[model samples]
Target: MLPRIHSKGNYQKQAQGNATARGNTARSHSSVRTTDSSKFSKLKEVLVNNLLKDYHRKNKKAGNDAIYLKAVEEVEKILTHGRLTDKQLKDLQRKFSAMDGIPEAAAVSDHAEQDSYPRRTEVDEVNSYRPQPPPTASTQTSPSKRRKQIDEWSVMTLYNDVKHYEEQKKMKEKVKNEQQRTREELAAQIEERKKQKAAVKEQERRVADEQRKKYEEWQQEMKLIENEKLQKLLEERKREAIELKRAQDRKKMQIEEDKKMRARATMEKRAQYEAVLKENEKVLERKRQQKQEERELDERLFRVQMEMAERQARTALAAENERARREQDRQLRLKAAERMGQEMENKAAEVERNIEERVQKAQDEQYRRDMERERNDRLRHDRIVKENNAFLQRQIQMQEEEKMRRKEEERLLAEEMKREAEAFKREQQRNKVLRHQQCMQQKAMLDKQRMMKDYYNENESAMTEIELRLNAPLLKQVVQEKPDLPGELASKINLN
Candidate 1:
């Protein structure tokens, strides 16, 4: 009972502790939400500034400057109010975006002589307080300068966050300390109560012990008085007992005489009753044996029927498990076959396309080679014909020269032969250049053929290896739990 009370107190304290912890958690979450909201407001400010800058750039008319100033003034006024709900903030942002440098027209159209900032409840407006922005801008600049300013703003925001974090940390620590102090006070009070209870229980036990001792002393005195009265009564009772014993002896003799007379009268009747009781006992024994045999037969029939039903149920369950296993296996195999078929088809098409490209390239190269050979043959035939005609003319010139060998000047002849030598040397150089070009063309063609062969062989080997892997049997898991298939099921499967 004492332990139950202690546990109850401890549970109550623990529940309080849980509640305190939950409150702290909620406060922390609320603070986080506040910080997020502050960050959101900062982002909104930056977005609005950027929008203003863009608007100022697009609408550079002198007439629109007043409109732009009014929009900025109204946005600043909206910010000067207390914290806005998401709906209000969204409405303000949407209105600003759709202003189109015409805030007065929209404001007047809705409500004449009304400002852009909407009104709120009087009590709430009285209670509201606004915090100033870190900074405000009204002009455009190059992106680099704007980016630098944004960086500075980010650092400022970070510093503020750090300060807030420190404050929250201190608050959490203070809450924790307060909770600890309360728990300690509760524990001390509980301890004091336990001590007080112990002192009271000790006093109660001491009093009970004293009362028990007093009761024993009173009982001893009463017993002595009872013993004296009982001794006097015992003497009186002894005299009365002697008188009653004499009267009982006379009554006993009369009862014995009456009993003997009754027994003598009923002797034949007693023998008849004994014979009937023995006959009844024999009939009851025969009936008991018959009932026992019938009960045994019924039990045997019930046990046999139960055994057959159990076997049938187990057999059907095993059949169902086996059928499900077969079905799953069939589905798995069908998926594998389909996937492999697709992979094979893709590989075959890729190989066929590659082969076609290689064949086309080879045919083009052969045609180019045939055309080059035919052009070379025609050029050789023309060169030979020119050489034949030139040789005939040279023979005629040589005969003329021989005739004029003694008649012509030696200087003129020598000059003519030198010119012929130069012409022949030029022709030989051109032929050498042509041969070099032909050799280079053959080398390039050979290199292309080698590269194509290498590419085709590599692709074919890779595809063949992939096909082999796909054809390979997948690794199958072995079931250690052997199926308890019915013998009849196995026989039927074998027959099918």
Candidate 2:
């Protein structure tokens, strides 16, 4: 009986150990499943974060429709493949909002708007029809009796909400991006036009400079030619003036020689007249009446000679007057040539002055044009830079607004998920209590059946004992009791 009791205790302990092992195995499997789910969740979070960062980083031209659409597609793929819950979606939205720096006020208003969606009504309806466990008598549930349940419709609704939010965001971003691109294109076109205008102006300026340079070169050549001609004219005038002076000196010398010759002839004529008178006087002393006629003739001849001399002197004087008139005319011509040369010199000087003025004026005009061009270019560049800065500011503002909107959506989602989770927890608690009650009732029934079976077994054993005593003598007469066998034979018989 002791060995039998000990063996029975051993069997009970073995059964209990097996039950504990099975529970531990179940717990281990559940832990492994939870660990895998946590890993997947972390991976999903990391993927979504990277995607959000990529999208946000592409704020400039990289934020064009193609990249935006690609990012959207990737997000959709993640959503479809990952099958994240509302909580997970909310977390991702929150991450996006955080990265983009969303405002809380906007989130509140968006949440209010979100509550009015038709899907929320569907979710509420589903919530109202939550499955209740059958009635039970217990107020507590056993830990072992607990089980997990999921609501597919609620998950689907949350997925739809996430998708709807993403779609709206995508649409807004697309429109904004297009407007930004258009503005940028317009600015670019304006810049290009300005550049073209500047290039054309520069070309014109270069051409003008070349023309000016050529004109200046031509002016120098003309100046050189004019100066050469003036120099030649002056040299020619100087040579002619020298020749005129030499000719005038020779003419004066010839006039003086003519005067001297005229004086000598007059003296010779007077001397001859005196000699004729003296001879006539001597002849008169010899023959008074005869010499009278001769003296009268001589006197008449002297008078005739005097008249010729007077005529000759008058002729010489007229010739001298003629020469003097010719000298006066030559003097007037020389004065006129000198005056003309002076006037030409004055005209050449005036021309050089005028040319200098024109060149100076052109240089000043070019300087003014260059300065004006530089000023215009500076103004244009400054304006472009200012516009670009304004554009960037506007883009940043829009991004902030978008972030606020996302944050609002995330907050609403989180609230809804929290409410659903609380409700689910309550339901789980109620179900667990019901299961515990059922398990208790089944265990009580099994205990009652086992007690009844033990009672019957004890009674049968007592009756068998009494019958064995009553049949002891007859059993010995009818059949001899089997003798005990050796260990080896007993073992072989038992095996057989």
Candidate 3:
């Protein structure tokens, strides 16, 4: 049972090895599979000879014969069994070691191992992970004592290449960063624009709301105004109607009063006309009675006048006869008296002639004395009248002068008193004016203070009013007394 298990495990290992070998062979000969077997072998030989010569040149001291034998053995094993086991690989390595000057053959085996199992290096792994660096000048320069200069140049070139690469990388990074920033900025700006548009829409809505509110307010105010106007118009119309009613009432009252007055006047006129008619009838009756009495009186007067005229005529005739007789008698008596007077006058003339002589002498003496006495009396009376007249004239002149002096003194005194009164009045007026000015200034100050202050009292106003009233009375009194000069002067005269 152990042998069977061992054998089975060995068989599986062999089968896996055969499959790996066949896959390698088929992959190696895949290019030449389309050619004839002879040509394929010849191409394979040429490739192997070229590979060996390259290996020999890299290791000059390597024995070519030993390397060729080892290569032929490897070819035979691949041709016969199509594979080489680990033991067979070890045997071929020993064969290469047994040969002299076959260092190239070992190197070939090492190269084969390297090809099968590649080793990872830091440079290779770094190259794979990172990017490739540009070629530097050092790689192209010949090896010499001036190699350091080449190295420096290579280092500078390498630095420049690295710097350029870094710059390009930075530039790419910068470009990418800028693109990202630009995209972000665009997005942010779009968001901000959306916010601004929303804000503007809100503002517009608010404005529209405010406008609507204002319009509503305006409409309400207009309605109120219209109502007020309508009320005012209605009130005015009512007032007009009331006035029209009042006017009509007044007109009716006036017409009624006029009718009453006219009726009263007509009644009074009719009464007056009836009274006038009665008075006219009475006057006519009285006139008729007077006419009758006048006619009777006229007839009586005419009879009396005729009888008296006849009696007068008869008396005149008797008187004429008596007058004739009396005239004759008077003539006779006058003639007798004349004769007697002539006789007496003749006798008296004789006696009177004697007495006339003495009487004439006496009369002449008396007339002379009388004439002298009359002239003396006339002279005395004239002297007395002149003396009285002169005395009275002197007294009158003295009185007149005294009266004139008294009148002048009174006039001067009155004028002085008037001037003094006027002066006193002026002084009072000036003092009053000053007082008024002070009062006005005080009032103004008080008013200013009151204006500056927050409150006022009634006392100040009452005091101001009292002061004004007092001043008004005083001024009125002064003005009223100013025109009393003529009346005052007239009152001073003594008529007696």
Candidate 4:
């Protein structure tokens, strides 16, 4: 049927292809046993319909898994070899119709050709443990031959049962582990992204803070420079005022000296004028005009001095106000910067917390999903195994009953055999007890080995996870250093 399945596709392809122009040659499929076009066409239709039926399960959706893909490949191989018989094709069709995937028969047939699913090999291994049928009474010739045989490796029989249970556990655990690893990887990736984002934000914040600090320092330096300029201007203004004061004093002194000299000259002139009273009246009038000019000059000097003192006082007050205003502005800037720092810290911490919560949620969801999947697999496997065991038990019981029936009639005539049988039964009981003990010991050892294997596997996975995390930081650093590089290139650097 495998070849026929492929031949069906081939025939259709040929019919639609250039081969259709030729009549007899196109109708004949040399690689397959079924040369009849109509029967072969029916075979293909039946195979496709059966496969579709199997794939269209509970949800009425059709899809392929590993088993389906392997079956297709098997069909292709059968066609390629041109060795498929009619019997194999019919058997293959029956299997596809009866099973959702390959059956034990198909697996056995393909074992010599391909090893697709190895677990099916265990079906034979498990069957090997069935106790051999007891020998007939006719074969019992002597009492010495009746002693129970105890093989050294008889423990293996009991171990086989444990092995099967462990195999089932391993299968379920394998799928669960794969899902767990995927979840962990996803979570790690998310965490890594969060870390990178935070780190970048922090770096940017630091850069901005540094720029702000530098800017503030520059402002302070500029403020100090302005204050110095104001101070210099105030001192220069004071110096100008004092120079004006001195100049005014010097002018006043000069006026006083001139008056004194004029008065002295007038006194000398008055002594001379006593001789001539009429000539002296003109000198006295000139003296009065000089005194009026000196008085006016003194009043102007006093007014100038008072204005200079007021101007100096106003300049000092303005400089003091500017210093106070600058100090207040500095304080405001420092408070704002401190507030901004606190806000940034709070925001970063909040983002970190939210990310952690999200990660924990996802991890829980993944763990739940893995547990559910593992449970389903174990349940399904156990059910199938139970059915198979029940069927085998029925067959064995029927065989035992048939053998017992056949020996019933001969039991009365075989007196010597009855005694031998009694002895053999006693020995068999002893052997059974011994075998049970050995099997228990073997089970213990196997369980221990399984535990160790599981422990190591877990450790290996943990180490792998740790390695991934360790590499993430290096990768991030690489990306930061060469930001202009393509992302692929940057990641590859750390990967290497």
For this target, which candidate reaches the highest lDDT against the unseen true structure? 3
Kindly indicate the candidate among 1 and 2 with the higher lDDT.
2
By lDDT rank, best first, the candidates go 3, 2, 4, 1
TM-scores for candidates 1 onward, in order:
0.20, 0.23, 0.27, 0.21
Best by TM-score: 3
Q: Across residues 1-496, which tens digit of lDDT does each residue of candidate 4 receive?
A: 0001111124246224322323222222111122122243234334444434443443243323334445454454443233567687666655554555556676566665555554423223222222324544643455334433434333444354456557756975785576456546645665675577578667756765785677578658867976896698679668867975786577568657755765675566555444344443444455445445544654464445445444544554554455456556766665555565456556545755655565567557656755775576577557756755775576567558755754663464366457756876787587668657756765675566557556644543232333345445545664875589876556554564
Clashing pairs in 1: none
Candidate 1, residue 87: Cα displacement in angstroms equals: 18
List model 2 lDDT by residue over 1-496, tens digit each: 0001111124346445544654544432321121222343234335544555544544421222223323344454454333456676566555443444335565456556656764424344323223334423441244234332347755665465456657756976786577456545544654575577578667756765785677578658867976896698679668867876786577568657755765565466446545544654554355454345545665565556556555655554564455456556777666555565466556655755665575567557656766775576577657756765785576567658756865786687679758866886797588678657755765675566456556644442231332334334433433433445456534433333
Cα RMSD (Å) per model? 75.7, 55.7, 44.6, 63.9
Q: After superposition on all CA atoms, how large is the RMSD of candidate 1?
A: 75.7
- For residues 363-441, could you state the per-residue lDDT of candidate 3 as single tens digits? 5765676677557656755775676578557656765886687678668867975896698679758867975786687
Poorest 10 consecutive residues by lDDT, candidate 1: 471-480
Off by over 4 Å in 4: 1-63, 66-228, 237-496
Ranking by TM-score: 3, 2, 4, 1
Q: What is the C-alpha lDDT of each candidate?
A: 0.50, 0.51, 0.53, 0.51
Residue 66 of candidate 2: its Cα lDDT?
29
Candidate 3: residue 456 lDDT (0-100): 29
Q: What's model 2's lDDT at 264?
A: 69
